[model samples]
Target: MANTPHGGVLKDLHQRDASIQEELKAKAETLPHITLTERQLCDLELILNGAFSPLEGFLGKKDYESVVETLRLADGTLWTIPIYLDVSSQKIAEVGIRPGAQITLRDPRNDQALAILTVSDTYQPDKEREAIKVYGANDKAHPSVSYLWDHTQDFYVGGSVQAVSEPQHYDYVADRRSPAELRAHFKKLNWTRVVAFQTRNPMHRAHRELTVRAARSRHANVLIQPVVGLTKPGDIDHFTRVRVYKAIMPKYPNGMAMLSLLPLAMRMGGPREAVWHAIIRKNFGASHFIVGRDHAGPGKNSQGEDFYGPYEAQDLVLSFTSELDIEVVPFQMLTYLPDTDEYQPVNEVPEGVKTLNISGTELRRRLKTGAPIPEWFSYPEVVRILREANPPRHKQGFTIFLTGLHASGKEAIARALQVSLNQEGGRSVTLLLGETIRHELSSELGFTKRERDINVGRIGFVSGELTRAGGACIAAPIAPYEEARNKAKETISKWGGFYLVHVATSLEQCIKNDRTGVYAKAQAGEIKGFTGIDDVYEEPKNPDLRVDPTQTPISQIVHEIVLLLERDGYIGER
Candidate 1:
């Protein structure tokens, strides 16, 4: 029999009544709305769909504290991760949020209302405690901890949510299923024992070996559950990873494996995450879950130490096995045995026998260099899918973002680099100059800080698309603020290599080279909120490269940048 769901019930909260849903939709329009971030949207979807089986809404203060401190809910149910509805103070005031008030939760992507929350409590979270307790580290190197401190807002509003409608996902609609739906699916398939595999990465040969071994050992079918929502930075996008997953399905034993997409925003909270994953798999009707070494672990902290012990995930999951309902299947490193032409556990291998293993880093290096991945490491189909998404670095796309004061020669160098790239004769090159963007894309925006950030973000968006399509993007924007520039870098870095070049032209030099006379106008009060005049410019503390255009000609400066790109594997030999 399939394992029971967490909390003994699937908490699918979507409104069933058309009239009530319509009424709620009507009321939601009148109430102030809070726009959910991508992570929160993922959480909301899981909540409504019962994938987060017991969570009907974001956690209240007591539940939040309980989950953080005890890894359980207020009702003493085993729940590891805390779901939050974090919002800014400005948003709080805009919504007039209070204990009794209702706030509509809207999807920013489509401007549609998804749920309504009766505000139970609003309070500031002790992020340090959250980081330390939930992630076992208050270190910024942990992606979730960094998000808590940096990207997350100041306040957390908690309540029970009433679903107006389920969020629509157009992509891979067939594979997305609620907990109840998936349980029904398991029943229909007559699979008594199901072993779910949790993955956020592309599956290689070793992964297939371990999963197949797990299923055969347990006498269970395989449920390949992969995260489709936000994962760690620099991870492959879900679209590409899904294609990779789809390609690998045929390699599994016939009718032995099935694919399902989990809209989960991973915390990378090693042990806690493993427990949480087991619960989710249980809700999905899986009888067992495979917990490998360092499952869901974020690599390292800034202190050069691992956040969790090597086997902590397996240990923690084992500790919660009886309560988790889903069986915990422990896994170890599988090595390829050339002599037997199969994979075996390291401990089972004969001493002095030749073994082959490819590390994830090594695989990525091979992909970037277009090096051959032996069939022992991955299937040819899987390799082909990965190569399509991650072409050789020389054929890949890249973005060069130049930031400095106005008249800082950013535009000059950008145009020169654009020409140089054009002469190289491979991919198309686009130059997004500050003045040109302001004139074309952001005509209505002024020189205010917010407007400048928006302008820079626009350039970043366009650059990301171009980079994704395998073209060179040169964006010369006076991206004065670090936060916006960082946002831009985050936006483009997912698609291809993103380099932030600080055009280190001094304020005095800018004034001297002011052919446009805009800086003079700003200083003379003719232009308001002009950067480096009425406004302050924050110098980049960690730029990829810094160049002084005053000290070198544009051609030489472009050459220096080309050399940097070549060094970073963004380009190849002339």
Candidate 2:
């Protein structure tokens, strides 16, 4: 018999002989009852070289030259039972293929028949069925996760998997607050007129311009609501994205624009997504929503086509304006104009402004190559974000996030606490100032609720790790709620050095100081659901230390925190 590339595979298969068949049977029996779309099945067939056909007779043989390499499974070790791509037979007919015909593939070794598979006879309209089918052992077929993972490296600069299916539905992590809860949040504030800004990507000048314009036009309070969920293919994950947001948050019109995560999946259907986005914002209590060109579009399609025309999504939303029960604010694409040295909408930009065509792909190439990302695409804080991302090759650290409102003394208190910890010079203390850690830690997690939880959760985890390693971490964030604080406490306590130091900054002083203009903007009705204005701020019932930003000095606050740590035995050595 002539030798073939799969000769060794066949030999290995034969070696295990009965064991191989038994293993295969077991794997098949335990195989997840997964189904696939017609296209997905076709793709699988292409990948498998037709050994497992969606139509017809079983018993086919094909050489998967690198099956062992692809999966760590050995020959005769019973890899997962052969899975057939599932598609509607009607679709099969539409494609002009004969139904119920057996398909075959050539076996690389001796042209031997080795395996045969079948396809589902019908489509499963049930979503739960689809979810189960998509997640199988050794199957990287979670449609949403797979799609994003497949394309993220191509589109998102320095992209990496940030978070997958995680929960943060309780009040400790997110204050358990909902859109309906906005009414009771800040009893003194008027939320009658609210504008919610929508973003699937991190904010830049262009986003700022659109939000500013929208807020000005509506004469309403702006809520900077960004999604932190599984987005379109190639989009950055939500975990890191939230950190980039937190860094530049001080720039947002404080109190007027509060940031929050939207736990929703992005279909990237362009016009349909825009319509869907509007409906969601409305459900979340937004009176007005922003829809820009190609809103939620998944970029170009096969044949190099833009999924929907620039204005298509906007037009569709406007058509259903009344039905959506929310006002539509259409925005043009924002471009960086060199003349003004800033970003402006395509329509209003001056002719003299030089155009900097910084595509996301180009930016990612730079990041991957260790090149400096132009400031026009993202903020300096975001640059830091791109750097700190650890791609899970090893679990050496955790991400710890400090969250809270503006002028909440989070940064100042964090600094003082860091200085105190630094006094333990021998210990490997790593202080991740929220603003500084955007590049390394926050780049992967996008601006979604799940992402935020992961980001904040990582922060807590890291702090706990450092403390356990005989190091100290002083993370100061306007971690305003109980859920996030609880997560930190839990993570750190597990490591044996847990502390929740609440930097108490009263809403009155935060508004009066007006360093960021956010509070002033909220009062002027330029923004809504401003965390301290329109959104609820749940105070810690009891904290290790409470530093009133209104009256305490930074030094005193830091000292008090250190004392608490020492008293609790979290100081000196691990």
Candidate 3:
């Protein structure tokens, strides 16, 4: 939900409300006057769908006009400030809006629409002023996969228009600036080289020592960039982590470092993530990104050993240096030397300096039980961060992935399996076939590649959800190729007992039994690049159980799968 792309909900709403469509087109026509482009228009439509649909009826009579006026005020700005709304707020007056919408800011004294004000060149001198402008999708979705990180009028929002100083839309900044923008901002301030620290956890002596070392070694400014959105399960929440960052900022070298939020998501990948982090920092304008041990790691696999060692992240960055302009500054694990009353790298400590090594897990445990972290473990400032980032440990579950081709009877097989697994009793079984989830997850303007990735990603989420609930998942998606199937296999296998049941339906038979008429469309070029016809569908070379939908009855297919699970020790014999 944190990384939810805007406009997905608006497109859905526009289908039901003809007025919204008219309003969108009107805004698009007027958006350019306010600096909104064609792309921003599309993005605004999406953001409307994602953010404002549920509140359609709740918006009062005067609110619509306020929205329109807000847009008028935010004219010609490349970056549009989003009109922030609180659906939970009681009064519509308490809510905010941009131009093109019929809403006005609430007046507390009069309990009526605030007097319409002209757009100001400066930030809104009045605290209550709002602005409306269409923000570009690029700004809404920053840190793109490829290059091109510019702080331009690419981002917009739905709200009243006000002066730049006041940020007329929402009262608070929706999010912090992107890394690229931060670098540009600092560069303007005369800071040339920056050392960006990537963190999901709070600062401790080890982290502090490494960061300090990075700054000294690289001769660069330090940027404490912490992820503020959905990290791996059990990680600390954003609010608490921000407080920790605030507390520890004073301890850092003055004028040599600064703190900011990285409005990005984390993928618990170790080596790949290291490369990703480096690239992100490069975009954010960092000259150097600190690659601490096990950087961006998700911990152990099923074997309970580390997925990658600390040096692996460093190695991953070194492996791809020329491409990513950012330098990687790697530092060994830091340990505290009590006798000397200082922190030192594990290798640098003398045999006599009362040395100690305390892990993050141990630190958290002590905190949860209201115990003191050893003085040698972390700085008092750093320990304050640990206190702020203390989150409850959550036990995650496993996911079951099912893949095959369209019309390979994937849905039928998935449904049958779901029923069978449910009948097994005591085990929670949830079936998420491709079609149903796609309808719920996908958008009209969604790109083919993103759609494909998201479709598969949703299946993975479902699998993780089902498995975590201590239940089983039966996901049947037309994976179409060995690569996708293998990815599904690998992702699910991480949870253990990931039975890859390949629904081996012949391509000819699938075309012959086409339920959605996709095959016919593919042949006529009506549907470009359809799988198994114009495109290829690689059959699974090896699957735990291969069922020919043409030959096997649905009942028998389900029984065989259940048998495989039981035989493989995933389920008890029944």
Candidate 4:
């Protein structure tokens, strides 16, 4: 039999009556407006769709406290995570939010009204306590903990929401399913036993094998329900992941599997998240949920230790199986046997047998280097989709960041490299020199450390955008701070390659080469906070290419940079 919805009943908060909805829509304009954050939008969608069943609205303080402390609601329903509508104090003052008041929740993206909230209570939450209890740590290393401390609003407002309309989505419309829709679909297909496999990453052969095995074990149909909501930082974007999922869907046996998209903003809470996910699956009419090792665990903490035990999520889900009304399918690690050309669980493999395994890091490295991804590890169609999304380093966009002291020949080298790259002529080349950026982008900015950081950050942002669009950005700045330069690299590397070139010309040489006498004026206290004189120029600890333009000719420095770019596959061989 299909599992019952959580709390023994699915709560439908949508205003199905057209007259009521029209009345609410007309009244929403007169009500106070509150903009919903991304997380809040995801929560609202689930709440309206009955995925968060048994609860008719965002939790009041009592339910929030109970869930945070004991993984249960105030009514004793098994709810692992607290869902609350957080608002800033300024927003509260603007909206005059109070008990018995009504407010329209506007979508931040388009400013469209999605729902209306009847404010029941407004109060400040103990974020630290919630973090420690729910995520097992108050440290910012955990993504959820960090969000709670840094991004969350100062006040939480609890209320029952009247759905004005479902949030708009333009992409993958056919794959997005609500809890009620999924339940009805399962019933129509006569799939009483459904096993749901949840994932935030791209699906590969191992994932397919694991899900298939899990379904076969329980004699159930499989649901590939991947989260399209906010996942960890640096995760593959949903567009690419969905493309990969679509490519892999046909590999499953006919009528045995289905693909669906879940708009879940994962908390990466590991054990608690495992229970939460199981409950959500149960509400979606799945009879079983797969709990993999380290389910929803954010990688490592600051001290380089795993945040949760390997089997902690599985164990926790198993313990709550009865209450959750869903079977817990524990996932085991799978390995490829080259001799048999089949994937087998590690425990089932014979000792001393040869097994082929590819780590995620290795796959990414291969992708970046234009190395071939074996079919045994992932399907060729999936790899092709990934490659299209994440092209090889040579084909992708990139930024060459040049940092040095003033008059260290950075501008000359930057111009020469720009000319060289333009001559090569495959991608658009943009040069962002210090003076040019100052005049064009940061005209109002000054030379303070904070201003300098902001200026560099702007350059990084621009460079990242250009790189993502497959352009070459050459940035020349006396970005003296290591932190700022590192931030630029981290930002640009997300979409394309970032190569830092340090022009390590000595301070004496720079002073000699300063035809404008800026360094001399700084030494004489005429110019305040002048780099390499009043202020310090921290040398790059590790740069992709380091050159002293004083010793190496301008052409040679440019050649070295081009060589490095070509060697790293950022450009074709000259």
Candidate 5:
């Protein structure tokens, strides 16, 4: 039998009529809009499509508080993650946002309006408290907790949403299914007792074995519902993962398995996130969810400690199974028995039998070094796809981001580094200097902190694209702030290595090195927002490489930076 949707209702919120969509879009154009970030875009889609059933809109204060404190909604329903629309106070006040205000939510990819929200309540979240309760720690190491403290704003606005249109996704149209659509598909196929497998990473042989085992044990068909929305940072891009999924589709026996996509911006809240995943699967008509060891875990914290116990996710999901209306199918870790050429549960393996398993870190090492991935560990086709995506480190791209005070000699280092990179003669090296970027990209922008961040963002975008291709990019900017530099790192690291080189040149030396006399002009108040004069240059707490240009020669500094890159395997005698 098909499981009931959460709250016993599938809340598909999109308006179907083309004329009505046009009318709503026209109306939304005149209302004040809060542009949804990429993360918010992912959440809005699920909420609109009933994958997050019972969540008609962003959570109100009561629901948020209830979920944070107790993992239950105000009505005592099992709801784990706190989902809300975070808007900045400046945007709120500029647009006169308040209770009873009707506002439009615009997509950041474009200015197109997706929904109209009737603001019911606005409140400042106790972010640290929420982090501690929901994530089990107020540590910045947690991805969502970091987002809450860094990227999220002070105000959260909540209300019911009137969907004008669904966010447009050009890719993977066929596999993108709303909860209602998936339920209908299951009904059409006469599939009862569906087992759902959730993953953000690309699957391999062991994963296939475990899912097949879980499904057969439960007498259920398999549903591979992988997250296509924002996954954990540095995860394999969904396009490659989807291709890998397609390659594995034929591996399933008979017609027991199907694939679909979920646009969930994961909070990485571990145990809480597992319960949330189970609930979502139940809504999508899955009777059972496969919760494996360390399910949805974010690895380790900065202190080199596991954030949660290995079994915590499965335990939490099992505890709530009765209320969730879904069965939790627990599976032990899988390893290969090479003698038999089969996979089995770790606990069931005989003591004398030899077993093999490849760790993620080890796999990455093998990939970087172009080592052969054993067939038992992964399918050749899947490995080929991964290899295409992740070339050997020497052939892959990378970025060197240099930041320092004005006249700090970072520009000279950037130039020198670019020259050293090009000396290899195979990789294309591009240098982006802040002064040149100011002329080229930020000509209209000013010296304000916000403007500086925008300039840095532009530099990051360009360098990131350059790195995405098979090239080396060196960018020197007086980025001045950790937030902007971190943003740059986030962008570039998605494609390739992002090395942050901090030129720790003293202010006095920088002034002495200033032949242009800009520092003198800044002291005379001609340059208002001069960094290290009237403005601040927040030093990077843990830059990959910190150099003193005043003490180290340019050639030696460039050599040190290159050695750092080579040691990390971005370049070598490949």
Candidate 6:
């Protein structure tokens, strides 16, 4: 028999009655609408599809309090996470939301209405309490806690929903199965026992071996269910990860495994999250779930200590196995043994046997350096997909940001570097000079602190976009503030390499070299709030490259920068 859904029944909220759906569609225009955020959309999809088996809609205040404090619904059903529809005061006023009022929930990606909510109540939630009780910390270092504090709205409105349509997904349509659909699939396949492996990261050889071992040990087939929703901020995008997953699927024993995508917004809540995952897998017709070491752990805390013990997730899942109605298969840490040419569980290996393992950081470093990843570590196809998504540094995009005082030779060096790069002719180069930006991007913006920040932010946004498209961008600006420069670096680094070059040309030297008399005017107080005069110019404490135009010739400085780029593999060897 297929595994039973959570809470003994799968709650499908979609309006199957064609007439009722048409009526709701007609009423939707008159009803007030709330645009759902990315996380809320994930929640709504699960609720309507019955993946959140017992939840027909977002939780009311009573159920929210119960779930947060006791990890159960008000009716005493097991539910670890609190799902709420939060709105701002401005939105509440615009919609005039209150008990007994009905509103349409519209998808933010498209304006299509997905569901209708009849409001049961609206109340402010204690975020601090929610963070501490549910996520085990009130610290912003925890990704979910930071989101609760930063991204969530002030008021939460709760009610049952009447779904009009499911959230439309253009990608992987066939693989996005609902709870009922998955149960039907299992029934058709006659798969009596299934073990699920859940992950947010890309699967490698070790993960494959571990999941296969779990299935073999339990005499069950494998389900590779990877989360495709909002994961950790820097996680690999689902598009790339799904490609990797598809590449690795053939390695599984034929007819012994299957792959599916789960659009779950993970909270990284460690032990509690592990239990929650098991319940969700049960609803998907999986009889067992693999809870690996540090499952759903958010990694190190602010003090650099592991947030949860390696076995904490497994232990917690074991404690709730009876009530969850799903077996918790504890993942064994596996490492490749070079002599045996196979992976073995670390605990089962002989004491004197040599073991080899690659850390995620080391894997990325190898990828960036174009080094070979051993076949023992991952399959060639998987490596190929990863390499395509994240090319070698020399083939990737980058930004060279130059900051200095006015008339400090920044623009001259920037122009020279642009010419040199264009002459080299491997990739397109874009130069964003301070004057050009002021005239073009920030024409109405002045030199006040806020305006200057706005100017730098606009430059950063453009640079980031260019870098993402594999182009080289050189930005020369009098970005005197450290915060704005750092913000630019952070934004650009997400897409490609970001190198900061500080032109540490002295103020006295800049004044001496100023044939335009701009510095002289500033010194004479004719120009107020000029950098290095009335306004301060905060020097970069540790820039990637620092140049003094007075001592180093422009040609030599550019040569030095080229050498830096070459050394970091941002360009080919000279």
| Higher-scoring candidate on lDDT, 2 or 5 | 5
Question: lDDT (CA) for every model shown?
Answer: 0.88, 0.53, 0.56, 0.89, 0.88, 0.89
Counting clashing residue pairs in each candidate, in order, gives 0, 56, 59, 0, 0, 0
lDDT against true structure, model 1: 0.88
Candidate 6 displacement at residue 308 in angstroms: 0.7
Q: Per-residue lDDT of 1-574 in model 3, one digit per residue for the tens?
A: 0111222232343355667555544443332223232232222322332322222222222342343333211222111122222221222223232334443223232232221212111112111122111111222121211111332222222242211111122311443653334645887879888889999887765676788888888787788888764476567667777777777777777787788775454545566667666755665667888887777766654456665676877896786666555677887778777667777888777766677777767876776444677756666775666654442111223344566667888788888777776676656677777777767665442425445666676676667656645567777776666666666666665544477778788888888878778888888888875677676666778877888978989899888887776654455532
Candidate 3 displacement at residue 205 in angstroms? 2.9
Q: What pairs collide in candidate 4?
A: none
Query: What's the TM for model 6?
Result: 0.94
TM-score of candidate 3 on Cα atoms, chains taken together: 0.42
- TM-score of every model versus the real structure: 0.87, 0.41, 0.42, 0.91, 0.84, 0.94
The TM-score, computed over Cα atoms with residue i paired to residue i, of candidate 2 is 0.41
Predicted structure with the largest TM-score when compared to the true one: 6
Tens-place lDDT digits, model 5, residues 326-444: 89999899999999999999999999999998999999889877889999899999999999988988888899999999999999998888778888766899999988999988999
Lowest lDDT 10-residue stretch of candidate 3: 119-128
User: Candidate 6 has which clashing residue pairs, if any?
Assistant: none
TM-score of 4: 0.91
lDDT of 3 at 24: 46
Cα-based lDDT at residue 3, candidate 2: 11
For candidate 4, write residues 9-70 as lDDT tens digits.
Answer: 12323425668667878888788898888999888878877787766688989989999998
